[model samples]
Target: MRGTPTLLGRPVPLGEVAWLTVVWLLLWGDLTVGNVLGGLLASSVVVWLLPLPTLDSGVRIHPVAALVFLVRFAADLVLSSFRVAFWALRLGTSPPVETVRVRLRTSSEVMTVLVTVALSALPGSLVLEAELEDRELVLHVLGIRGDVRATVQADVTRLEGAIVAAFGTPADREEIR
Candidate 1:
């Protein structure tokens, strides 16, 4: 039977080792020879001691699209920050808020997670729950006015499209377009 692939007779994936080593170096805030060697040893030992089953997550990054997504997200973040600040400083009345349920077109776990994190990072919106089976996200959103639900839905859809364009599988990218 075929078993897990190994390097130098050890079940350690080079990609994981390299990534862990980078993380180690960042944690130490240094990039010395000793630190590099220590990182390599620590990462190798961690991977060997705690083996994890490999599964294809079907995610790929398109640099151009990723840049576009980042730019748009930054703009959204800035705009949302201003909106939330205005609401906070406004008089006695609170901004109209509601729990909005958004149905996602793509059900990929990676896409779902990306969407959740992106939405939650914005000031006026917070993702309360993600129903994987239903491919839905329940979000608590502030500053709801006329037709705000439609606007929020459209915003989420646009965000999903951006994410799918940036780092989704081939099928996901096509479906999103």
Candidate 2:
């Protein structure tokens, strides 16, 4: 009998442990210098001692793109809040419900997840799933009327573009296309 293959052929779950340590530090650490030092020591010790899986990644520091994303996110939140409030005030009327599939351009799992979460936070749309094989997203929308497909498509495009600008490399943009 052969054993099932694990991530990178290692049985160790390093990523999970690292994530747990980070969460613990964030949740339990006091906002004092002593506590900060203690937390850092604890986290460092745990990270150093644990046998973890390794994965490669990169980070980008794009100030202008980050600012643009933040501004758009805030604006969307405000707009969605008003739309929800309006719908709530109108009570008992039939809301136009529609299911729209958004085709995502970016293949990065993190970027795709971010887009899903952001869209779901908006008042009208909820992301049900991401079809990874086909790069499509299923969303349930409320009060969608007159060309919902185009609107959803446009929204997805804008989000992908913003994410690419903020965090993607030149290679990532090519992958998205």
Candidate 3:
């Protein structure tokens, strides 16, 4: 499944084995055939049994873009964690955690769900609720730096863009801007 394989003319399963193998190596902190084989089997089985829904055929992932997205996400996750930690350090005078409604850049359900997952995966934000029809999420966020509403909305847009860059069509990338 190299070079962006698609299932039923839809994009999905973006190197599932590769992701799992990398995760396995990270967990084991060693590169070995046993570990690689183990990851391949485990990941393949899971995906085969419970696969993610395929994205529309128009969705196409550029390898470079996906790599860039992964790096950016890791950096964002670390930075957001630090920001949340700094906020936690503030004792009682902590800024209020605000709920903001942010519209997503992609209207596709899968893309929207991916954005939702990305937002909830971080510590600073949680998806309070999802309005699928409207392609919006009510997110509760920490660390209101300057403008609470705009800050949250911008962060959400950034997160969505990262995902779109990693696994979206050329059209998706254009629409995000």
Clash statistics: count for each candidate: 0, 0, 0
lDDT values, one for every candidate? 0.90, 0.73, 0.79
Q: TM-score for every candidate vs. truth?
A: 0.76, 0.69, 0.63
Model 3 regions lying over 4 Å from their true place: 1-59
* Model 1: per-residue Cα lDDT over 36-117, one tens digit each: 9999999988888886787887889999999999999999999999888999999897998989999899978899999999
- Residue-level error in angstroms, candidate 3, position 141: 0.3
Per lDDT, the best of the predicted structures is: 1
As a TM-score, model 2 comes out at 0.69
Answer with 1 or 2, whichever has the higher TM-score: 1
Q: 1-177 in candidate 3: lDDT tens per residue?
A: 447655556443658767876887899888899988897777766666677765556557779978987888898789989888887888887656888998886877767878888889888889999998888899998876678888788878887887888888777778778
Model 1 segments more than 4 A misplaced: 1-53
Q: Report residue 44 deviation for candidate 3 (angstroms).
A: 16
- The Cα error of candidate 1 at residue 129, in Å, is 2.5
For each candidate in turn, give its C-alpha RMSD to the true structure in angstroms. Answer: 4.1, 8.1, 7.8
